[model samples]
Target: MRYYFVLTIFSCVFAYEKDLTFSVQAGKTDCFYHKVLPNEVIDLEYQVIDATHGELDISFQLADPVGRIIVADYKKSENAHRHTAALNGDYRFCFDNTFSTFSQKTVFFDLMIDTEENQDKEYDEDKEMEFGANSAESYMMRMRDISESVSRVRDNVSTARRLQELHSAHEARDRNRAEEMCAKVMTWSMVQIVLMMTVGATQVFFLKSLFEDRGSSSYKKLIPGLGSQ
Candidate 1:
């Protein structure tokens, strides 16, 4: 039992998660590479957040060590995929933004690789043995199950919270954009009003000057005629 406990601790320590967040510009592509041994199992999951365009879909592909494309997806917002490494070399995955012209995107991804030989089998066997050992063992098994259930619930809650945050961010971005447009429209309207007022005032002043000039010329002609008589 002591040996098993130590082994489990080591296994948990070795099993780690890799996280990455990156931005891709319009009409560009980003790639990530990872090296793995033969027969290794890989777990991958990703999400796109805060895109200039709504819906936030992007293209992606996974290539093997020898440059063979293994998995590919197009216009996906979120995804989870699993793959088993067949060759002992570097593997690559890429996010593509070829279809977008002006919108940039932010992406978050995670990778988990199983490195131990027959790790799943060993763990399952250990769990079975421990469950059948004694009364205390059975109680421990039940507690472990409960713990696992709680962990799953926690993961669900975390995912929900992430989604909520992303949605809120999207809403705020849209609101800001709308406010900017409103400001521009109001400024243009004010400029137009000012221009119209200036043009109208100029026309009125010119007409009044023309009428005064005509009346003065008539008076001068009449005065000359009266002096000659």
Candidate 2:
């Protein structure tokens, strides 16, 4: 009976490791919805399998349930290999694969939370220790701050994408309009030249007829109008 009881106590104080599989997309960013509580840290570990085809940009934000940011930053090669969290409520991880338009890549994330009551196990069990109210309050405040930052980053990412698409669409429309205007100008110029030629031919024919008639005598009455001929 004592052995079984000891095992139960040990189980409650054990660390947990979770494995999550994420497939990187081509030309799009994927957001993973998650939130963490205080006293727990979300550790993200990733592996790039086929980085030759494309690259990956991973970022994370720790937030509160009501949407506030506490800690947020992109994963850099030097700093993000293993990340530790202080306080967290809703923690979101975003993966941007838009830069890798040529091929698809697979990435894995390992999340571990030190949930064991005595993870450090350094506290002397002979004496009881308790966290004061002040410490608890401080932890709560940190959680809220992290939540807010996460929400802001997420919003900014989406807004930036929308702006980029709008700019591209506007430029394409402007280019098409310019091409149409050039075609119209060329067509109108050809029409103008053809009309001018027809008028010139008509005037020449009338002048020649008048000159011949005046030399004979039939156009003697109209001779005054043929002085310039």
Q: Which candidate has the highest lDDT of all?
A: 1
Clashes of 2: 17
Residue 2 lDDT in model 1? Answer: 56
lDDT tens digits, residue span 1-229, model 1: 6565555634532443576678889999999888887778777877776577655789999999889998899999778788888999889989999889988988877777765445545656777777677557765565556545554565576557656655665565466568767888999999999999999997886676667766464445545765345
lDDT of 2 by residue, 1-229 (tens): 3353234334444455555555666766676656555666555555443332423344444444556665455633212333345555556666666655665545555555655434324222311232331345464444335534544564476446545544554454456456666888999999999999999997886787777844564455445665456
- Cα deviation at 189, candidate 2, in Å, is 56
Model 2, CA-based lDDT? 0.51
RMSD vs true structure, all candidates: 8.2, 18.9
Q: What's model 1's TM-score?
A: 0.54
Each candidate: what lDDT?
A: 0.73, 0.51
Model 2: residues with Cα > 4 Å off, grouped in runs: 1-8, 55-88, 117-229
Give the clashing residue pairs of candidate 1, or none.
none
